[model samples]
Target: MRGYWNWLFKGDRPGLYKFFDRWFVFHVLVGASLAMLLPLSLQATASSILLPLASVTVGLSFAWSGSAQVLLQSAEIEQLSSFRVGGIEEYVYTFQTAVLCVLITLVSWCVAGLGVFDLVWPKSSIPCVYGMVCFLLFFMSSVTVRECWHVVVGAQQLLLLRYKVRMDAEKKTNS
Candidate 1:
């Protein structure tokens, strides 16, 4: 649990500073802005998009993990096998991303379920609490999106690597 948290935020880097990477900051800003400007209904968003999006991301992450394994075994990319992000191998990273997405989705669903309860809050604090919830939902959604993007980029890189390897092999055969 702590390991995953560290891997997600610190990568292979050391220090708390790594937690404030640009993408993290970007997600924070975007989520806060959205929460302030166009607060969304957490229940509605979770029920409609969050589950499906996380499902798709998980599937893609698995595929990417397989592709990464294939790439790792390729003789052409033998030297590239050492590539690591935050000290984690590419295949491990994909699997971790998938897990993270699912976890986020589950958390979102739990938050959404809270709406079923009729808990009363102080009138003065209602808006503040609601806004905080909204912010949290938006932040989690943004994190999921970021994970999806990472999987997509990994897939693209795998395709390009395969293409390059094929092209090189063809050139060798022709020569």
Candidate 2:
């Protein structure tokens, strides 16, 4: 098991990234496991956690990438190669998404804290159970989204690599 894990994360590895990767895989498996452990109606409780956490992640990511100029500067592209979209567009998108996420979290957090879940189930500790469920769900989902992002960006990187390779081949042929 140790060897397997070491092989899986051969590099120093981004801890957060790794966490999300495993999280997504576990998230899928847990759905099947939940069916075994919980009634179908109870499964809806998972969303009580999922939405807020997802909101936090998007909010923080936007705050970091948009408002935090220092952080963005480090990774900022001089020129975008893939789409016409550039830094300005990214800045606007990030900030807007961040604001939206903040609004969502605020509303959801208030509802959850106000015992909205309890209103549904009524005095069976449903709120507490859903609260815990939401926490775990949000945690796993945030990481999962981060992990999947790598794949999406990696596909774009591959496209750029192919273009470079083709250009190099053409140059060689011409010479």
Candidate 3:
């Protein structure tokens, strides 16, 4: 579990504070601002958007995972070795990013489910507590979005790498 967490946040990275990077800060700020300004109820948001979004993200993650596995198994390691990039580690990172995105989406979905069920807290009795819950859901949803972005970017990188490898292989054959 610890290794998975590290891979999710620090894949192929050399920093101890990788999880607290710029994107995380941006997500935090945006989430906080949205929580404060958006007057929408958590229940409504969860039932209307977050749940569907989570399902879509989970599907994407699974598809990305399969694609990564296929790419890694099919691509020639020797060809990748010639590239200046991190080689296998790049693909590993993409898989890790997709898995991380799925994890985030699942967690946010659970939180949103609680909101939908009014299981977080009694809204009328403890307004402050409900507010905090809303904030938490918003923050988690924002993080999930960030993770989804990372997964998409990773997918694009993998596609580019595959193209490069194929072109290089064709050049070698022609030569």
Among all candidates shown, the one with the greatest TM-score:
3
**Top candidate by lDDT:** 3
RMSD of 3: 4.1
Candidate 2 lDDT over 1-175, as tens digits, reads 1233332345354222334444566665654455345542333453455466556555455444443343223222223322433333333333333344344544554554565644665434565565454554343444345533533344345445555656776899999
* Each candidate structure's count of clashing pairs: 2, 2, 0
Overall local distance difference test of candidate 3 = 0.64
Instruction: Name the better of 1 and 3 by lDDT.
Output: 3
Model 1 ranges with Cα > 4 A deviation:
1-20, 38-41, 73-75, 83-91, 114-126, 162-175
- How close is every model to the real structure, measured as TM-score? 0.63, 0.33, 0.68
For all candidates in order, the CA lDDT equals: 0.61, 0.45, 0.64
lDDT of 1 by residue, 7-117 (tens): 555644533342356789887887788768863455555567655765776776666767766665666555444553432243455556555665765666566646531
Clashing pairs in 1: 11-86, 12-86
Poorest 10 consecutive residues by lDDT, candidate 2: 72-81
- Considering only N, C-alpha and C atoms within 3 Å, which residue pairs clash in candidate 3? none
